[model samples]
Target chain A: MSLRPYLTAFGLQWKIGLRYRIAVVAGLVAQMWFGAVTLMAYASVYHAAPDVQAPLSLRQAMTYTWIQQSLFTLLPLGCLPAIGDAARTGAIVYDLLRPVDMWNWWLSASLARLLGNAVPRAVLLACVAGPLAILVGLGAWSLAGPASLISAALALLSITLGALLSATIVMWWNILTARTLSPLGSYAVGTPLAVLLSGMLLPLPLYPDWVRPFLLAQPFAGITDIPIRIYLGTFIPGGVATGLGLQIFWLTALTLLGRLWMRQTVNRLEVQGA
Target chain B: MTQSPSHTLSGPGLYRRMAGASIVAQLRYPGTFVIQAIGNFVTTLLSFFGIWSLFHRFGSIAGWDIGTVAVLYGLVNVAFAVAETLGRGFEVFGGEYVRTGSFDRLLLRPRSTLLLLLGHELRLRPIGRFLQGLFVLVAGLWLAPHVQWSAVLVLPWAIAGGAAMFLGVLIGQAALCFITVEGLEVVNVLTYGGVEAGQYPLTMFGRWLRRFITFVLPLAAVCYYPTLFSLAHPDPLGMPTWIGALSPAAGFAFLGVMILAWNRAVAGYVSSGS
Candidate 1:
């Protein structure tokens, strides 16, 4: 298939995502604040009981939190605002009329928006949380580098898959909005599920050992947790390959299932106005 | 109409009726509401579980155990949920009212803007966060080693104060919208970030953050200070025990200042004047 329409869709949403410079800065500050508080909490917890054989060391957990906070926007928080607006104003019908493949068009936009929102914030936050914290004599709290060059390369690949997996999840929310005729339901359901499961609130490795396997197996874990594991070179159930495999698995499975769901939603959708 | 809004309701009665009607409307979608609430509860509960898991591995963090932390967690969340429910309108004021030019319609009404905004809707979703926090608080109180009988008397006072502080943050955010609606994420740092910060003991934070929350925002003054008092935990941070009772007043004072700021913002607002 031709790539022009999907690229245009991607470009449009990417520009919209990058447009809000102030919001990006604001979100960075908020994430920084959260990261600081979380780091402190971990520090105290780890310090109070140094002898415990915790799954993640204090440094690893801090790094995980910093990266997680930096990539906060990469999580599938809700349906795309454009889709929500379209659904609300009956402009979604025009989206249906567009001559491009609906799934690809929406997926490109979803992926672009997530990248646009996430990339700048992640870079800026990494700089501040990594180098800047160390420069300011807070090296103990800084975001550490990947376990090795191999891990770094693998992490980059994993994060790309992570972002795509996140966008794929957003597609599910988009289809849900199209089905429900309201974006509220998507957010009400999507946010908590994504935040909790994706290790946004806490690193999946830090969770109880019994729960860790189930947490790893979940689709949300593939979005960030698995990639972060690869980055930290932490134990990923079977091995590092298993972490990357999980991301690829979720991305492919979700995309295939999402396309079928989208087709069904569109088949049944009835726009109120002509 | 079955009943004229003006005839049966006036002042606080009207506010109650407004809240009541909104509740009734939400209740119409019982399934949706329940799902959202359960999602919220589980999401928060899982985060707490992360903390529980850590404590399971390590005996305590910074001398405070899970129970004390839970009390702190419960207080801030319950407070935030209450503020979020009541202040949903104010939270969305800039986007829903100012950006849409609906602020003009609100002005056209005879009722006070504060009442109208406060009455917009008592959101049901945060109830999930509230209930989850309450569960943690009760559990924490039971499990904590350092409890006193006076906790029963002091806990409600602290919750009221924390709610006041959060509401103040929301109002301050609404007031800032008068200047620009672009950077509201900065305020989310205070509100959502505040909830995260309040879940831990105040002393655990760095000096700057501890001071900012205690003085500028009073989040710590209301939450951490009172929890310390309730648990009868000695001040690792050097504040006297009696300070908890008086510190909650800071929350109220913060709210008063924010109200004035809101009124000033309204006065300065230049309508489209069509």
Candidate 2:
């Protein structure tokens, strides 16, 4: 359960990953190229129609897409497959036998992997988006500092919780069957639900009368949309407080669920005789 | 339930048997299959909603009406869904097959690598997306109230071509993974980014992007020009409607190039053992 062994494990994985350094760099470059294409498309669309709905101006939409592309680094959709693979291969048994708390061990491993993967990719994506952001004249708002920090923190929390939840599912079902559900859970259930409910996609005022309350009720909107709103200095008094409160609530709930699942699954561990 | 005989299959027949087995393996978990199909449908639907919402807000974009845009969306989705389903093997080749070196096993089989890979996985769930696309296409046709029988007849060819193009992108991605998995993002610019770009008319983009899609990627050949012809919209790019009608053929040519690249990459991998 100590941090030393976990850190060692993390370091080992990092080294192995580094051996394929070219592949990693290539992947980053490919992502940046697409990011550039996306920026260009957004710019073109904005030029064609200067105003895409009331609240979302050409600049804001471009900025929003940039931020979204950048933060996409923190998404946990990819982690579940790793968990599922380990479970399927019965490697979870070896992973669990290590003298570490199951949750802490897995979390550390994933965090290490994420750092190995996301950090470099994020840097590259930012480099790509930064020039485009400037070229598109994305304003350097005063709130960018606070908003970005908050968004980053939220993104990390969301990814961790998402990974845990996904890992828990893999513990029950192996990778082959889990493939379909995991992506659905991550993409269909988690990301968009978060986007829609968190109020990230549209501001509350812009939403129709019937949908506003429902959209506000979902926890996901708070993850990205709320931070963006705050960055834009559009957060009203009560809404900002409520959004932050909801984010904390969701994080706590997800963490608890993950822990419970991990404990139960580990207790029932039936490592196949390999 | 009677299972098919294993020994009776040979050569192309063996490949068919293998493909059938893979499909059956997927079908073993019908619940997962249904959920995944629904998930894909929902995700694709959300994208359509995004486009629809834009149309609702702006009435028209780049001189294209909602219905015309819907047709474009439908065509792209239909093509993409078919590609995602049939080309599931190629899509995962980089991450799953090439990364694990299972591609060598594929080569050892007494069948064309393409057939064996195509048979490796068949995603039935994207059928949900395909149906949604079909609905959209029909709706667009109804809304436009146009009946070009020739264009209608060529629709299948275009869809096949588009599928081939996307599949080629996936294959190319897998091939590049051999060289370096680092910049898989560039492939996304062609695959995922292409889907988004193809959803709208190519003329909506800047000259550079349009040319990239047309010459480098040939996406416009599959979707935009044929769409203009189908909707009776004048080609802003000055290409005749017949060219659009014939554009999907380019997709096959693209696939041919990718296959050659894939073969070379595989040969290099075999020699270098990287």
Off by over 4 Å in 1: B1-10, B105-111, B181-183, B272-274
lDDT of 2 by residue, B120-214 (tens): 77677788889989888888877764647676767778888899899888888777777764236556667767887888777767677788989
- lDDT score, candidate 1, position A13: 93
User: For each candidate, what's the DockQ?
Assistant: 0.70, 0.35
How far off is residue A96 in model 2, in Å?
6.1
Q: Over 4 Å off in model 2, which ranges?
A: A1-53, A78-82, A91-116, A131-213, A236-239, A256-274, B1-14, B92-111, B145-147, B181-185, B259-269, B272-274
Clashes of each: 0, 15
Global local distance difference test of model 1: 0.88
What CAPRI grade goes to candidate 1?
medium
Error of 2 at A212 (Å): 4.6
TM-score of chain A, every prediction, order shown: 0.98, 0.65
Calculate the i-RMS of every candidate, to one decimal place.
Answer: 1.5, 3.9
